[model samples]
Target: MLKSLVVMAVSFLLSTAAVAERLKDISTVAGVRSNQLVGYGLVVGLDGTGDKTTFTSATFRNMLNNFGVAIPPNIDPSSKNIAAVAIHTDLPPFAKPGQVIDVTVSTLGDAKSLRGGSLIMSPLKGADGQIYAVAQGNLVVSGFGVEGADGSRLSLNVPSVGRIPGGATVERTVPNAFAQGDSLVLNLNHPDFTTVRRVSETINSLLGPNMAKAVDATSVRVRAPRDPSQRVSFLSVLENLEVQPAQEVAKVIINSRTGTIIIGQNVRVSPVAITHGGMTVAINENIDVNQPNPLAQGETVITPRTGIEVDEGSGHMFEFAPGASLQEIVESVNQVGAAPGDLMAILEALRQAGALKAELVVI
Candidate 1:
């Protein structure tokens, strides 16, 4: 009877662990991804926002040279309205020749803005220096700037860059192919034993009995059909199969610059007393000019005055009993009138005091 109870308890614990996650969300086939492609190009048709030839003479000269024309020996290229730019885009996986993709154009020279400009025929190359796509389209500037005779102008975030949706045509295809061998590999975005086992079990149940098995926390190997077409169809079905991903253990992330704080839903805080206080000092300077009476031969003198002040407000300490949850922690913090920023500091302090149960990450 005692032995039966022990077996039952162990079985229950194992069953709880097995149901954590299914499969699809945790793993993906290896060697399937997007590729980055970049190139240098020029944008024309700007309303006087193009690069001055003196600053970007090479770009202007090259552009004219592309059209089978040369600058007169004494002519200045800056007089021409043109802009030198760099174009960037990501070639999605399986992109074919003649397909269109959006491109981003950024000024590489001293051009003030790219508004109302048209990008010339630009060949975008990858790291291999091979042209993968040809980009040429009207530029779309999201911001605008205006200046008056008084040299006063208001500008938005950035006017020097723009994008062209479906602006580039793929002139070449990037070779991306997968072949099936004795086994197929599954790569996990985040590696964990609990997740790997669940994925293996789920695949095996769908395909057959134990056809897929975990090689490690990060990789799983599965058997595939010998025919290429069958393997492709099999993978299509495998990718859509749903698997709930395991949640990360408790953690807190704080961005100090933005004063943004995010805590994982599973984070827990232990009970402890918290008290916060801050000091502010201010200094003011005053200057006064003393003038001589109307006709008197007195010289003017300046007087300097300085004032310093400090403020101290009422402060209180609160106690938190043990076994406190996140809700209780928030309530206790609110009761002490702690602002978000102050609460962030207090949370850090609590972590150091061994009262906070999760890892504290500050960015």
Candidate 2:
């Protein structure tokens, strides 16, 4: 009976571990990937926020000349209010011609802002130097900026960068074909040997034995039907096949610049002792006036002196029990009576001292 109890306990633990996370969020099949496309274009209809015609004269003249308007070779076309910009977008898997995709346009010139601007017909080219799409639409700028006299100004978020929703039309198609091949590759977004092997094993188990194999830590190769129509069905079955992916080790990531800290759910700290203390020094200046004989037209003078004071914190150290939960760690640290900034330092020290079990990644 005691042996049976041990077996039941192990079974319960395994069942709990199986439902920790979904496989779809952690792993992906390889052949499916997004392609990057880029192009240069001009933005028009700016209310004086466009590039100055004087500085970028050549760009303005070329754009006008493209529309069959000829400027003399000697003439400088710098005064037209147009901004040159670079457009970028991702071409998803199975993208075809004539489909619309969103594009982002960023000013390549000294344009103050792209608010209330329309992107002209810009041919976005791929790495092959071929026109893959053309982007032309009204830009949707999300940020606001204002400036006034006396150097008064207010701005929220980024003003110069903006995104255009469905602003580009596909003009060409990439040559990559996944449905026509006899084999499919699954690519893991994060390369992990254990996860890859488990995904391959799961796929093979769901399909037929030896149907999927790990090519590397980041890729899995699977055999599929040769016919395009059958391959599509095969992929449909492949994507729906579920696999219990391995769990990521617990870790905590902290960004010092923004004072942001993200703790993984699995993060746990071993019980340890901590103590924090600091001294604060403050100085204040006071002025005094000494006037010689007010009625006798005496010159007035001012004297200044400063008062110095020190404030120190009374600190005590407390030992936490082993296998302390995150709450326990936080409470023990807070008992030191330190500010958040000071606590950040204390946590760093604790992590370095081998007390923190979770990986501490500071950025």
Candidate 3:
């Protein structure tokens, strides 16, 4: 049994390590990333579902003034077919001028819905407070709602938000350091010293010694060609190289809300014994009648009787051997027929007693 258990554990580790991943899947170029652009705008053509805030009215008056149609201060347009909204989109890395991107529009006021609305021309700005793109398009709302005269309503998905595919045209490009540095840095999605060392070694094996260096646990600096075209080709090859990552640390994850428990393959338990049991008590009430047998004048009376019962379930004791593997722990728990809550208590107790040789995370 012990031999089979060891074999199974070794096989599990071997299988996990055999899964090699492309460098592009595991790491990203240090300076290449997307930027977020945001803007405030107004959506028109709503059917009696527009915002009635003072700010919306002010924005409407300002827009009309821009078109040389001034409105008197004493009169309010009170348009119910317009809604104020916020627009946002992600400017992809290497996005050039005139390229189109998708944008999300959401209402900013008490508007019931933004269905059948068109966004006005709005300038999207980046973190540097510079206009990067212009957004204007009809919205594609997926959700709708309905209300009855009696105040009862039924709704599907949210109707106050919508998306416009390829709605924004890029007008500016965010500069990156991809072409300015002599060496390029690759940042790992997940940092690990062993993984970084292995990545450096793999790159060096392909380009010769001293060509790649592990700068830290999360980054590797690699020498590349100076010419732009040659550098692109060099990076393309490096990003495709296959490298095996190190195994994750031993951990047990518990979702407190959903009662989900996940045990990692590396989790182990020291020798320990545990017992689970519970006691149940039940009480029942019964009504009894008292009657006069010989005396004819006696009145019948009623009384109440109560009965109590106690049951103690048979407790089962389970023991774990020293350096028990994840499979062994699971098998032992199954043998005891422990429920999810019971298993959680057992694991917590083991952690407190220093018998669980892994990190216990309750999320």
Among the numbered candidates, top TM-score falls to 3
Error of 2 at 54 (Å): 5.9
Q: Any runs in candidate 2 off by more than 4 Å, and if so which?
A: 1-23, 53-55, 144-159, 266-271, 288-303
Give the Å error, residue 70, model 1. Answer: 2.3
Please give each candidate's TM-score.
0.82, 0.82, 0.87
**What are the per-residue Cα lDDT tens digits for candidate 2 across 1-363?**
323332353355446656633445665645566778898777777777677644356767777888899999886665335687888999877778899999998988888678888888888887778888888999889886887888798888766777899998888878665765668887877788888898888888888888998999888889998888888787777776666666566676777886655555456666777776778899999999988996888899999989999988676788868877655555565556555566568668878888777888888
Tens-digit lDDT track for model 3 on 1-363?
333443465567657765999999999999999999999999999999899888889999999999999899999976889999999999999999999999999999999899999999999999999999999999999999888999999888999999999999999989998887689999999999999999999999999999999999999999988888898999999999999998888988887787777778789999999998877899999999999876588888999999999889889998999999877887888777777778789999999999999999999
Clashes of 2: 11
Compare candidates 1 and 2 on TM-score and give the better one. Answer: 1
**Candidate 1 accuracy as TM-score:** 0.82
Q: What is the lDDT of candidate 2?
A: 0.75
Off by over 4 Å in 3: 1-17, 279-312
**Rank order (by lDDT, best first):** 3, 1, 2
Task: Please list all clashing residue pairs in model 1, or write none if there are none.
Answer: 23-243, 53-78
Question: Residue 113 error for model 1, in Å?
Answer: 1.3
Error of 1 at 255 (Å): 0.6
Cα RMSD to native, each candidate?
9.0, 7.3, 4.6
